[model samples]
Target: MPETRSYTLDIESLDLDGQGIAHHDGKVVFVDGALTGERVVARVTRRKPSYDKAQAETILRASAQRTTPPCPHFGVCGGCAMQHLDVAAQMAVKQRALEDALAHLGKVRPDQILPAMQGPAWGYRHRARLSVRLVPKKGGVLVGFRERRSSYVADIRECRVLPPHVSALLLPLRGLVGGLSRPDRIPQIEVAVGDQATALCLRHLEPLTDADLRRLRDFGEQHRVVWWLQPKGPETAHPLDPAQVDALAYALPAYGLRMHYRPADFTQVNPFINQALIARALTLLAVRPEDRVADLFCGLGNFSLPLATQARRVVGIEGSETLVARAREDAARQGLADRTEFTKLNLFEVDAEWLRGLGYFDRMLIDPPREGAFAVAQALAALAPAERPRRVVYVSCNPATLARDAGYLHHVGGWVLKAAGAVNMFPHTAHVESIAVFEPSATAA
Candidate 1:
């Protein structure tokens, strides 16, 4: 191989992936393991016409925001990208990302920037999907997240992002898998840590023998965890023995609510941050006691039930039938069934006419997936002043989509972007969760 070229570069900014950006001979270079305002020696790993990818070899000047990563597998594990940066700095980067997306992609800016919502950085991940691989060369069974960019699993003995009790099971889990009847048949382990108990869903391609079941039982007994086996899809996942495990649920004590979820369901990964986000979203929504509210793209009644506690009526619209059913059940369980209604609808395909059918809502809360709520935004924009909700609180996972939708709501729909801010849901990752509030423009006809 030809000698690799090395460049001394000054890191200028951070990309969405938390990589450092530097200019090299008029081309953009993305440097891994480097921070903004730092001068580093980087080795060109891949070159492109417009941009290049590099790995930082040495830091000539360290940034004040830089801090030692708490996790030993920080650089190697793709599970987290911003672990090396201080928690405050991580929030700053995410805030910048949200602002940039809103200004550049959405062409709208919030009138006020809400203070960043924060929670515990370490041991905050309540849910995670760990990759399992039987690599004889590496050892026996290697279990952890995939390597930074490779498909290979990182040999992680402990994960700082996981709760201490769950993290302690990593090595034992490796042994458990390695001794299974068909070690190679297992692909991944889905971890869901609830308030009362920890559950692990093992995805195995082949059947487990009686011996394998006994071993799993013994592991669960020893570790005080519940074992769920998934032979096929997520729907097929069930506890090995239902009597041995407590139902998986997380408590939102402030609301006196316990939200039940399955291992495969899409609940917020950080329970603490999720509680904070819900409170912030609701406060931004400013629901009134007599108001009829709409929770669009609501999952598992995460927000709807809380809204129902205050609002006279709450209608939740979701694309997933399963989630809708679960949300409805949760509403009934919470005694909010009389106030809340959930319906299955692909919010992505909705238009103005369809939104009108739901009647007028005094306030609306939107918590969309990464795709954001473009169709719903358009529908809301197209509604007449009398038909539109006076205020909207949009909770978004993708800042770009939120910005785009916010821009349309402001520039096209005659709405005002009231306030926006980042929520540090995944503190050690580049994932930006944001909440933006909107209201009809004062001058709109």
Candidate 2:
């Protein structure tokens, strides 16, 4: 067993995970529930060769930026990490973390730090995969997020980050699952909310009985929420009552577009922030009526369809055939079939030859997953001066990967890191969503 000891330390800074960083006897210590510039008594929870992990036992001195977390389940639930920190301070911390990652990991910095994107901190999460556990010892079925650093399900009555209607379903969900025939077989619930509808995709390990379907329908009717059953995988999900429920969709009022997505399809977790992000990205790309833009890793054409509104032509490329088909269908529905086109390709394996075949683009929009776009950067770097896009806007969820790719664009591709900023998509959480603009150095001349 690890030895436990208490130490009063002054928090010097915060780590990327929102934990307070302090030094005790020359060893770095990470303390949870502690804020920077605060003095706190912490109990060591774990020990390592170079650093220690602790939980704040008592706050002797508090920082002005610290605030009382509104969520009752703030500490126990693993969903959010920085609730105790003031909202403004939370944004500042994330911005600093992004800059630190860029400087230290990528050896590059942007010319200007764009103002951080802000949105409603609470009730912003529109997508979440809630864990469902039937623990008899912990009182019947438990529904919500998992316990912090534990495998046990958190016994949360409600969540502040989720939509109000969805948050109100926690207790009811627990009861619904508890009364089911095979409560233990139900492993998880995927929540997806759009402007018009809310969907709950229940993942059941074993086959659900006919009675189970009836119960789900009854629950959906009571809550006025759509129900989807996932017996095997995401591809197996289907609506309980397709005839009664409308397809899940969210409108981008600014772009005059509405995006349709399945419950299992990937969409931004925060709709409001997504709207602001799309606007900012489009502005940074500076699309003109005659401009032709390429959107790489364009899942469901979230950016492509919007770009088509301003740009003369937009080509969206994705690795998933399903997403490409959906993008094309959405484009056609939006009467943008003439201005937009989508293709399915493995972007991770993209080469200069493949890129050249796609034709010329004045600007490029890349919203890659956490792995980043190393291949895309390499392909752009290999392109001749005449064929390369003049400007590129990168939307990233991981700052480290974004910085690395930014470095490649700057050092290897001879591009300039014009500007970058953080978008607080998942507020009160450590997940950083950011955007960066890169242009050829020659453009400055």
Cα lDDT tens digits for candidate 1, 165-225: 8889889999999999999999999999998889999999999999999999999889988
lDDT tens string, model 2, 2-92?
5488989999998767799999989999999999999999999999999999999999999999999999999899999999999899899
lDDT of each: 0.90, 0.92
Which of the numbered candidates is closest to the native, going by highest lDDT? Answer: 2
The residue pairs that clash in candidate 1, if any, are: none
Error of 1 at 221 (Å): 1.2
Give the TM-score of each candidate.
0.97, 0.98
TM-score of model 1 vs. true structure = 0.97
**What TM-score does candidate 2 get on C-alpha atoms?**
0.98
